[model samples]
Target: MSGEWLAEVVQTLQGLGLNYAFVLNPGERGAFIRGMGVTLQLCLLTVPCSLLAGVVLAALLTSGRPWLERPARALVEVTRNTPTLVQLYCAFLVVNMLITQRFQLHGQTNPLTPFVWVVVVVSLHKGVFHAEALRAGIEAVPRTTLEAARSLGFSRRQLLLQVELPLALRFALPSLVNNLVDLVKMTAVASAIAVGDVTYESIMIWSQRDNVLELLLLILLWFGLLTWGVSVLGRRLEAHLRMPGYGQ
Candidate 1:
């Protein structure tokens, strides 16, 4: 469609209070802000948690114990093989139900809030993929580097912290950013559990206004802006972290 038509649609929607932030209703505007906040909060929470879990899982997968390593590998494979939506649903409905019922905590406050559960599940699901990325990066690090660190009296922790992880992280940075971008988009699934995220709020607004196109456009704009900004920032940070000896 043409820019003029798009602008006209946006204008008409704004005039009819179909836009995300309806000026006529303070409550609707507040809800929109809250939803945006929730989306941001989910992304921020999930990214770090997923990255950390991925690193730990990668370490476990690479370790010497056959049982632990095999199981870790299997878990990663299973998680990667499963569809994310099914995983989210099963994790939310079935696993969550089992946990609540098994603990006899039905009457008690749920330990996992809707927001927390969204972050936790998304992080863990993405963590599987990230684990593979990190594991590959770790393996790509030269064995000579580890031996060099050992010969220099570096402890295991020091070797990992100073030598392995840094180099591995550099190699994994682009993939990690890609994973984070996916994680941000996946936050839309939070709407399924009534998390009051952007998508949920947009749906509610559109239901009342009967302006599906307007609401959807706003959603697209918001997501596009957010993801684009994130990509730009990631690229800049990646360049800043580039190793002098490493080729682009």
Candidate 2:
């Protein structure tokens, strides 16, 4: 009985000209799984790298030194102002070319890989937002806290790292999580550079089978699931870090 139903369903799908069988094929599945792996790798690597870069940039911007602050501010401004796709192109084509040229001068011709360039551009692009969030978080720290730290003879470094950053992170976490979700979606742009992420592989498969609609729906489902997971995790973290008796 179940076999008859399954056969009818397959026949109906065939009559509709939908080739889900292509998606189930071993080669196609492998390509998609590999692409997903690359996407995940990009997300995993970009999240921490961007966060660290953002923290450093935020610290520089708040350092009270014109020399450090100006350049950091400029970087954040330019990155935020530019489109991410353009940044990826410039990093992969122009910056990588320059670096390769310089290396070639020393008889070393090491070109940047597409994966590296994508990770770098995406991280830097998202890092600008993280920097602003962290900066706001830092400023949100009460002045009395800084005074207390100073009274305890904590050095400037200790005051910033120990006293300020931890509290700033909690304040900035919601924004940070939002940025991470954006970063995961932005990984789709890596396909433009032939990094073989999910979007790229999907394109390849759909091109061969002319199953663009099915592939697109699958893509949407995959990204939806990924972003949904990130949101759930962020909420849990926010709850865990909520200050007792505050924001009640």
| Candidate 2 segments whose C-alpha is farther than 4 A from its true place | 1-17, 105-111
- Model 2 TM-score is 0.92
> TM-score for every candidate vs. truth?
0.87, 0.92
The model with the greatest lDDT is: 2
Q: List model 1 lDDT by residue over 173-206, tens digit each.
A: 8998888788888888999989999889978877
Against the reference, the lDDT scores of all candidates come to: 0.82, 0.90
Candidate 2's clash total is 0
Looking at model 2, residue 156 earns an lDDT score of 85
Candidate 1 segments exceeding 4 Å error: 1-23, 103-107
lDDT of 2 by residue, 41-109 (tens): 998899899998899999999999999999999999999999999999888888888888999899986
- Compute the lDDT for candidate 1: 0.82
